[model samples]
Target chain A: MSNIALEVRDLVKSFSLDGATINAVDQVSFQVRSGEFVALVGPSGSGKTTMLSILAALLTPTSGQVLIDGQDLARMNEKQRVKLRREKIGFTFQSNNLIPFLSARENVEFMLRLNGRLDHASRIRSDELLARLGLSDRLHNLPAQMSGGQQQRVAIARALIHNPAVVLADEPTASLDTERANQVVETFANLIHENGRAGIIVTHDLRMCQYVDRVLQMQDGKLVRTYENKKEIRELARGSIH
Target chain B: MKNFFLASYLAIKEVIRNRGRFLLVALVIALITLLVLFIAALGEGLANGNRQYVANLDAQLIVFLEKSDFSISSSRLETNTVKSVRRVDGVADAGAIYTSSTEIVSLPEPLKVSMLGAEPGRPGMPPVIAGREFRGGEAREAVMDRNVALRTDIEIGDVIQIRSTQGTEDEFFDLEVVGLVEGQSYFFQPTIFVPPATWEIIRPQSQSELTSDTPYPNIIAVKLADPLQTETMSARLVDEISNIEVANIETTINNIPGYSAQQGTVQTQGFFTLLIGILVIGGFFQIQILQKVPQIGVLKAIGSSNGVVGLSAVIQIIVVTMIGVGIGGGLTYLFSLGFPPTIPLVFNGSRSLIAVILLLVIGPLGGMVSIIYAVRIEPLKALRLG
Candidate 1:
């Protein structure tokens, strides 16, 4: 309980679409301890994006609370929320959307620069992360110069460069093939387990669900079930790993 | 911060990538700058011409007649009126000047000249190139400008015809062209200078009775004790005279009505033209922001703050603006050389500097506006994109 990295209580989010109120995320609850790798698995429009947005503090939940290390997220203003996202959370997106202007190394180093923590001290860490991502030779290549998997790997490196407490990856494997996807998932799992830094990956691919410690299923913007699986592609809604 | 640098780097990268659009914007800026420069050059030439003319004269002010529009003929200042102005507060000295515009028939081309009759000590009419100055009270002796002397070759003893404005009575007198004065104005006309007594002989007071004009309008010279009081004295004279209109400083410089107003309009139009430049240039950056919205979202999701994003946008704007204005101002200065002498296009660094600063400020302001649109973008939307 004291090691819990994230705790969410009954969260709700609604949007008016064509004058009809649709609940994008409704009464979602979950908890993950430090070092845990959690997977939020669901089909498209299942509120995974909305949940991820709320977790990142980019969007405020309509109801309930989000507690990261027991610090309630509901009380923070926009400034504090931005600060919280800067200092504690890290994100890796689906498309490996790297800034085209910078080289591979600068792209990864960006996470440190934003928090006003970029300096000589961050250089070694950025280099190390790039190397660990198997991009040491291509560290100077821009996003336009690299392949899909390589860019995604660099993005992951960017997310982890700041040593954030929690890493939020939204469909990190969507743009990659199976081999690349597996490799990315394994890399993420290895980093989370090694650093004890909690990570939550949102994916619809059931094949990759076995890599995470727990998988939460969402329907109609609510959590419907949880599965714990160590085996890849176990029966959905039937497997659980402790 | 890491986020700001990252954001700015991305913004700049987007702009540099679209080299064609950026170049187009710069070219348009240069064109608009050229128009303003053209007008400025014309203004500059006019000012220079006036200054050269005034410096040659050593006269502080030009006194022209103030008259009612009711009469068909142009009214002239009386001989007594010249003395009365000489008695006015700021007057240090005075001279009687007689002027009439007439065409001389002897040359290959009929030259129109302003025939001046004075006592020969006026500030501007000096140094007779071929003859002496208008000597004291000589009714028959006259001096011509250099170009006039060259055209007719009328020496010290030749006679010339003074065409009367009344259309029938032309005075053909042995007007001895005693001297020739050097000036560009001489090239256009045969300017003859005679004493007031000579003007009295040539066009007598008998002509004044036929028309509303005074026969001998005094050719006045107003020597101000203090040059600074010139404005005050001019204003007082204008107010005292029910018909005179005082031309302002800028008007005197450009010799145009409301010169300051015209300058102000040109400056303002230039400002807005540069504003259009900003929009076109800044529009590139604004697009830079929107295109990077997804990237910004990713950064936000990755723990990058909003301030970091905003800072990056502003930095990108600063970079582009400085470069754009540098190129723009440089081109403005470079091409202004070919402008005609009739224009006044002064390259004022301070004014251009202010324009550049305003242009530079527009860049950041442009970025900031885009930043508002950027940081508010949902990090989650980045997740949703294909």
Candidate 2:
């Protein structure tokens, strides 16, 4: 079996703005192994969001391949890509985009429903997952009735419920308080590690890097450095990195 | 099928959760349904009003004066013409029919009725619903349409006083109501069937032209030996007889004064109402889809196929529209019950059913644009992530 859960092979993404070609992601390559929780950290306009979008199969790269479990995204048609996204990849946007009309539990179960795996067992699993996320009492409440932190937790549960091979989160704690942010990041990390799924999160706050197994730092559309040492990761989490 | 159920469940759940928002759209659809159904009913009513009398005729062909434009009122056939028509080959029976407008002297106000004179038990006479057909040699007996009988409160064995004219002055004739027929109206007025002798006395005759003291009937209604041979037999009659015209029942009914014009006007109005219904439904759903773009994007981002999202939207529209149409149909039934029979509003089951089917189909047809717009909503742009 392949140990790598996700592989990005020299991915490049370009856009045209005002008749000028700008590369959003330029020849960046990385691999996330199974059961590893990594963080992609960068400043605004560092192309982190664009990179995450490509990994989630929401956007196509200009060149290069995104492989999930050794199957290349570039070689697949749109229908195949959609099926892969539904069955193997999970994502939570920065907005915690839960359907407003659905209850907290229904929002999380929606992923399984999309894959046609929702059943009584999955429904019970949904409740248990919400309970794990400290939202047992709010499962029946709509997104509008839940707080920002609570909605984010529901989104995390939704992202992991379908047992996707790769879980991609972009700024999962952007709207939470510091304590709640730390708690959410810690729980997100625990879920990823426990589920043995390759996970990646993009965040500007280096302090959130403490819960991650590795941190890939980026600048100017390139992966500049990585913090894999525990001491170095601790310093990075403390915002003491030079 | 499971995917469809999921889509349907989501659609129903959202509609239930947001009942207030959806109810507003449902109310608009209900109003449109009311207008459409009413227009359909009105069109049927106006058409029935024009054709009810002629439509019920048992004759296969109607003979008229050659230059009378095939109008029953303008056709003045002599007794010799009726005898000549009956003697033609393939002509099974020819009955003389006379029609005129007269007033029934009733309480409160006089009711206008179409006076029709036909031989007893002939094809020209309407079938009786109650009492009995005119007995042989019963000249003073009359058979009233249900509308006239019900409105005038005259029953069997009751004497009906009708104001008639002979030549110069108006006179009253007392005719006993021996029978009642259902839904017989002529020229937009309730009809009363009388025998040929009473018709002659009530019919106006000129004093200077009183020859043999006998009155000639207006139109001759011919029943062919084989109904399918109407065209050939009708041509034969017109060829054999002079100064006469022959037409089938439907063609003669179409030639009724103002009938085609009235039907065309009502039909045009009904079509316009249907068009407006399409526009209203399409516009409502388009706005609904526009407001739900981000939600749709979230669904797509979660890996829902285009079919799922589109099916959900279509299910929502059909559910809401069916409810609205049901309410509208119920309301129409309730409101129509209060209308008097004279209101000229006829609601037939088959026509209403057809109209309802058309209305139901338009719900999906009109929402197709919204479905396309929804399915085309780009996840990246809608989520504002790229």
Candidate 3:
């Protein structure tokens, strides 16, 4: 029922490596209404990932205000921020990033356990999420036992299992083959359309841009353009957008 | 919290993935702990045996007779005072002995000895290895330690000259070897025994006139029907035994100059060695925690809290250290068995237990420091690196 799941204004982040200051993200501002699926498209090293990190509450912008459902993240303390993050944000990395020692089910259930909320519903949800992701047959399989695509699905299941309001994914299909990438993109689209979650997918592959409802293109630490439709993005691919 | 548990599970997985490093650290910590413990345990076990051996000889208590606050010159108790102490209430048999240092010459070289003079009815020293026993009133007879007696001419009726100093011509005497004793000296030098009457002739009198006290002998050996009455007997000696000192053997030998003080020094050194062990563990784990920064970044980026990621490393460190130190300490105890009692190595349980606990704490405390640094590793930066 919230107006926006995530809102950022005048975000600026720079890093001083050795003695020179390099601006990684500069004055980037955006908002995601509930159930919005946004794709961040940028050239390599164009600060797309930095913008996504700031949105996920993982990175503190050197100067800016990030608000989730009207709560300002810049003002929240560490415990409050962690609580907000755990309850609100989900992340899917490009690398299948599954815990190598844990079984697929355990990886899903671990989020519930980490919350220290052991309920029948959480357990049921973990099982249901794995099955929903077509991983019911590979429930007990570790990351090594599963293929890259299977691992990516498990990672998605982990992200959504906690039922967070916002899901921030960084190149969720980078390690997958073409088919797996499409499947993962479809899942992200479903997460917004079917589950009413705000999802941000940062990717270089324009193929995934079709799954997102909106697309933002970046160039040199700035959002140079935005597109209101993913189908438009897929149909019009001349490396220029407005 | 869910994020925390998930991250923790993941960290442990990552930690174990680098088994070669973790195992090596664990093994080194355990082995070092074991080695120190082995030395310590052996020392303590042997010391316990020595203490027990000394206790069984029936020394009720001990007393110190100082030549001065600064010096430990020899002093004698008047013979008449011995007769008076014999008359005290619960009065039992009491005799005199002289303790001294002298030298013994065998095949390889001349060895220094801590000597004790025996009188009648005073329980003769126990034999563990054995040469022979001292007989009464023998003028020219002495006893050597049994351990080395077989290899030398320290046999019965063999003459061995005992000198008070390396170059001193003033104090020397030849005596027929009478007996040998076993398990006598681990902390002490190899022992030689002579008769109390012979000691009366051979003991060095102080040049200071104040020390020329009337006495039976300086050291009195007592046998009581009731050991519980030591306090009463001690009091009686103060008042009743005129011009004679009746003190126990326990306090006298142990209270010798630099004796008790040296024990404190050894214990302190042992304590710091344990601290060094702890620091080594802490240092190794600190470096390990630093190396896992990227993993922590991944967890944090996934919405894991600092508490979960930091404490996971701590728990991991504690588990590894306890396993390592436990095995090390156990092996140390086992290794101690081969050490002889005369090795001057003592394994003190209280000291070692203190060391083990101290060593154990280093892991977690060091983990805490490392965790603080680990938490500072930006999750965003970590993600970028990944």
Clashes of 3: 24
Q: Over the stretch A54-86, how does candidate 3's per-residue lDDT look in tens digits?
A: 777776788988888788989988777778777
lDDT of each: 0.67, 0.87, 0.68
By lDDT, the best candidate is 2
Instruction: Flag the better candidate by lDDT, 1 or 3.
Output: 3
DockQ-derived CAPRI band for the predicted complex in model 3:
acceptable
lDDT of 1 by residue, B14-67 (tens): 567655665655555555455544445444433333333223444455455564
Give RMSD to native, each candidate.
6.8, 2.0, 7.0
Q: Give lDDT tens digits, candidate 3, residues B11-105.
A: 57655765677778878778768766654654454444334334445456432233422112255545554455456676566555456666664
Candidate 2 or 3, higher DockQ?
Answer: 2
Those runs of model 1 whose alpha carbons end farther than 4 Å from true positions after fitting are: A17-21, A229-242, B1-24, B46-62, B68-76, B79-83, B92-223, B226-286, B303-308, B339-386
Worst-scoring 10-residue span by lDDT in model 3 chain A: A233-242
DockQ score, prediction 1: 0.42
Residue A138's lDDT in candidate 3 = 98
lDDT of 2 by residue, A1-242 (tens): 43899999999999999999998898899999989999999999999999998898889999998999888998888778788888888888788479989999989888888888889999999999999999999989999998888988999999999999999998988888999999999999999999899999999999999999999988888899988998899999998985
